[model samples]
Target: MTTTAQPQTGRAEGLASRYSTFMSRHASLMPTFAALAILILLFVGAQIYFGNFITPRNLSALLLDNSYLLILAVGMTFVILTGGIDLSVGSVMAFTGILCARLLSEGFPAIVTIPVMIIGGGAVGLMVGVLVQYFEVQPFIASLAGLFLARGLAFVVSLESIKVEDPIVLWFGSTRFRLGEWYISPTGILALLVVAIAAIVLQWTRFGRTIYAVGGSEQSARLMGLHVARTKIIAYVISGVCAGLAGLALTAYSGAGYPLYGVGTELDAIAAVVIGGTLLTGGRGYVLGSLVGVLVYGAIQTVISFMGAEQSWTRIIIGILLLVFIVVQRVIVARSDRRR
Candidate 1:
């Protein structure tokens, strides 16, 4: 017991220190933890109050319902990290969904239609990125134009909801994977998998680091020789692809594509991101935290419904909460600046 530690143990100790440092720097994660706790409590409360809230059937329903939102949030997290915004995400998703439905209506196989939708979305994103990065346009303004354009495309394609009729594709939306004592919908599992992959990409990759660097300070990032323009452009491309896939998820979930499907989804996604502790100014956030934020948001919606509030109350509460978070962020940023 009195023997000194082995040299190999020093490396382990160092690794632990590094991890602790990372965690401490990201102490804002407390909000996510608190959000998780609240959601768990709400789930239990829902079980008591609603009787049907925590059933396996209900669990599956919640997952299926929110899958596309999770997908859209994944892309939004990337865009927000660069201190930029993508208001067009929801509209873009609507556009792509209509495109997929139209293609399937034309007898295009799912295999062919999927890539076509995604590639088309990517092209839209590429053009937006070029406008923002190469042409030096403000992101908000550029993305606003994109939103209008995508909405116009949706209207031009069809002003009404179109049904999807592919039996094979329908299965993806309606199927469930069963295990002993429980089952989960395919859409739910897909959303979870997408979130996990996004977390890894944002947390461990050079590209991820570059995103943070750009968000933290563009001039400093440029001085560090980061490919800022390329990275920024790629971020939107990823966002666009996510939107397209989200459209597919929405279609599969609902069994149809509606021109009005994603109206205000950007606001919901933005609220989730801000609540997740992502700095509005950029450079500080976590993907896992964003997931927690999403769950928290969903829980709030669920809880409000349980409390018998009108649907309109949900929007009011969301707006108030967003304002509170913005004020808190401003104070924290100010204090941090002073300390620096």
Candidate 2:
């Protein structure tokens, strides 16, 4: 009996050691894994409680409803991964949407209007990046200025909602490809494409590697012959372009654009990115994790709606989860430091 008990104890110790070692080696992924687990559990529990919760139609709806937010999260992932923030994204989205609507209303071709909207947003991002990198302004302050500029421009475009009537624009939201009960709209497909491209860029490209290096330590990156300023500026540009795409998605989804659209949405993007396992302090994160984060956020909203609770409850729940993940991140970082 003593010999048998000794072997079991040894096995338990070995398993614990292996887990600890693995965690130390991949500390950055812990939060992402946690977010994914939470998403799964939330889905399973909701399905158990609400008999129709696990249907394919409901799953597709989740992607459809959150496609714009998912696009914004992809860009936010890039900005945040580099230890920077872009407060202007929400306003930029609103600005571009209204701009697109106005252009389409004024007889501008969809082909022309789309590129104008995208370039407009990228221009704003470039301004913010220049302020941060060249003028030595803090990212927060630079982006705040950008936020005001974009919002003011949005209002200047139009105070009232502008309906989008372009065939191409409407096609993105109205058309759905169905597989039995499951379906995906063009907007959803676009969001997925953005995520896939971003994941590949971050995982395989030299610029992507430079982004990580800069986030990890700008000075070290500079010493390593990396182009820190270029990377930072390009990151902001990418974020801005993403914001523009999000605007297009949102406008398509709603069939209208208002100057007031996307208010406080930057916070949502940041929250989703952080909740997905990206450290607020920068340097470690995944584009795929951002997708999971968006799903988790959508799941929470769905659960709250099913409970017949107030919409504000979703914010409360997300806030609590965000805090929990932040604490988890700190612990993981500390453990990694100790290991090093």
TM-score per candidate: 0.88, 0.97
Q: In candidate 2, which residue ranges exceed 4 Å CA deviation? A: 1-13
Q: Please, what are the lDDT tens digits per residue for candidate 1 over residues 84-120?
A: 8888889988998988888899889999988887887
Q: Please, what is the whole-model Cα lDDT of each candidate in the order they appear?
A: 0.81, 0.94
lDDT (Cα) of model 1: 0.81
lDDT of model 2, residue 49: 96
Write one digit per residue (lDDT tens) for candidate 2, span 1-340: 9999999999999999999888778889999999999999999999999988988988999999999999999998888888999999999999999999999999999999889889999999999999999999999999999999999999999999999999999999999999888999999999999999999999999999999999988999999999999999999999999999999999999999899999999999999999999998889999999999999999999999999999999999999999999999899778767867
RMSD to truth, every model: 5.4, 1.4
lDDT of the structure predicted as candidate 2: 0.94
| Candidate 1 TM-score to native | 0.88
Residue 252 lDDT in candidate 1: 88
- Candidate 1, position 324, lDDT: 70
Best by TM-score: 2
Clashing pairs in 1: none
